[model samples]
Target chain A: MIKPTLHSGEFTYPEGTYFQAGYLTQKNAGWRTARPVLDTNACVGCLQCYLHCPDGTILETDDKKVTFDLDFCKGCGICAKVCPKNAIAMTPERGLSQ
Target chain B: MNTRELSKNEYFFGHKACAGCGGSLAVRIALKVLGDRAVAVLPAGCMSAVGFNFPQLAFANNAIISTFAGTASMMTGILAGLNARGEKDFTVVSFAGDGGTADIGIQALSGAIDRNDDILYICYDNEAYMNTGIQKSSLTPYGARTTTTPPGTVSRGNEFRKKDMLEIVRAQGIPYAATASIGYLQDYMNKVEKASKIHGTKYIHVLAPCPTGWGYATDDTVDIAKAAVDCGVWPLREFENGVYSETPARGGDKAEYLRRQTRFSHLTDEEVGAITGGSL
Candidate 1:
């Protein structure tokens, strides 16, 4: 399990130290009803989609090809828009089961 | 051009903003135009929440956190310190939300502009206090229903129109002031590029849409922002050297724009007619 970076306890940092407030875990963005599907056959391993994934959903395989965890992908279409080989396609969640 | 043609290096991304957040996209675009030599001063706003994720900062450039109403003065101090050190190769930008800019930070903003500080102040107007729940703000539109301006039996929504921030910027006799939208990417980017070259207090008010606060689907953020400008609700204009030049109006369907967001859902037919038939 990922340890929480912040807690409800006393302030730990020293004075004059700056800090930001936000959830430590990756937010559940699965409400996006759509996700990106990558065609590995046409994938050029350019890593453009990996660099542009805002939610950090895109992961790299051992073969240097890119894949992403759909659970966190918000389907912003940034990966699709940035794909050089046009290998990534955003498909609706319900339609994927069909 | 899309993100591919803009630039390869990304300065800001992989943060905690909601999906299809126009403010996040605006930060990306602003950083794209400002380039690597820019140091961003973010106030207590959405950008602060998203950009600085604590121990894992998303912004690649040098960024500092400022108090809610202290961004303008902080930027001015940074500029002055850099000038004193003979470091004239960097740019300073203050990115704040509507609440931080139009409401809390306006005093410091006026003072900075009055001093003619060489900095860029970018107000990403999502219309309400979105970070701390949707609350009515001075920049919120007249007919919008924020948490503080909920429609009731005797009341509709906010009865006051948006504060004219561009006019306020112009009143300072600044060198450049403009309004932008993410829908008009090329135009917005062009304006940022131009502002970076100028040497005075430049302000660009971008119409950023909040999906959760505005009660719209995450996917419709860009479309709603575009509709807002095309429907005459938010006119895209630019002021250079005390001259105002409005962009050619693109008459989009106003009814469709209002029907998409729940904040403006309480608007009556007569009120809609009034908005459509009025100067807009």
Candidate 2:
């Protein structure tokens, strides 16, 4: 997560634009109508979902499995659609028990 | 390069782009291929609007927003400035939309290519001016409904055919030019990788579907893009060193591709036939 430094009126503004690498400080999980639920046992790690995700929210696990960074995922469900093994399902966001 | 060998580091992430935004996907994948040393120039389109939000810049690389008609001009300036400073191993690229490319920024793009500038210009053609609401761009296909070209009594969406951008750039005698779709990931990736290694001006026009503008379910973005290519509505081709070659279309059902989108829901059989050159 990126922490933005707020600019107050006291300090002089720098001439050059200086910023840390781009990152979102806010979570877009609210945009999801349905969230993807992964079936790890049925998964063959082809990384199709990882390659096709529009938001770059899917991450490859160390053990060759895949996981979602729900904090950044807008729940587009491209992962579920591209999954060859049908290892992913789009469950309604409201149905998920927190 | 294969998917397994692609860079693990994400250069573009955490933006306000809509869920299943195809333009974002194109930018993300291209940036991944270009790596961190890429200097991205964006015009006043969806990308700059979504990515450069004051204190919340979404690009992980060095990115700046240029004027709407100045993406290529700005890229040339950046390349010149970098060259003056003895900079090496940096790729200067631009991500412009359909409106920015075929209409507003064509002159700048032509000038850059005429000069044989070392830059890469990528037009993520979503087929319309989607950022300011769906308006008809020069690249918007015939019979596709947009805000400015709504279908009505005696008027059927945009009447003009899409401007052939690949051919236009090819006519300019560019060193490299290619048309790609997000559906074919490996092909698009290879084109981007190949474009980066070339020394002169490169233009890649990628068919990036807009789910919001096209009135399709968000999950169907890639499927719709693939269908366009499969049905021969969008052709995948490349122009290099004065030669042109195209991937053969799979000859899929054009009606299936059209009926899925609300924009073409009102297209008559005759109109569809006309758009497909009686191929149906």
Stretches > 4 Å off in candidate 2: A1-18, B278-280
lDDT of each model, Cα atoms only?
A: 0.79, 0.89
Kindly list the per-residue Cα lDDT of model 1 for residues B134-227, writing each as its tens digit.
9988999878899999998777888888999999989879899999997776788888888988999999999998888999877567667778
Q: Give the chain B TM-score for each candidate.
A: 0.96, 0.98
TM-score of each: 0.82, 0.95
lDDT (Cα, tens digit) per residue for candidate 1, span A1-98 = 11113234344553665544322334445557778888999998876665445454566788867887665567777667667798988888885652
Native contacts recovered by model 2: 0.49
**What is each candidate's fraction of native interface contacts (fnat)?**
0.08, 0.49
Candidate 1 has what TM-score?
Answer: 0.82
- lDDT score, candidate 1: 0.79
- For residues B122-146, what per-residue lDDT tens digits would candidate 2 score against the true structure? 9999999999999999999888999
DockQ for model 2? Answer: 0.47
Best by lDDT: 2
Candidate that would win on DockQ: 2
lDDT of 2 at B270: 82
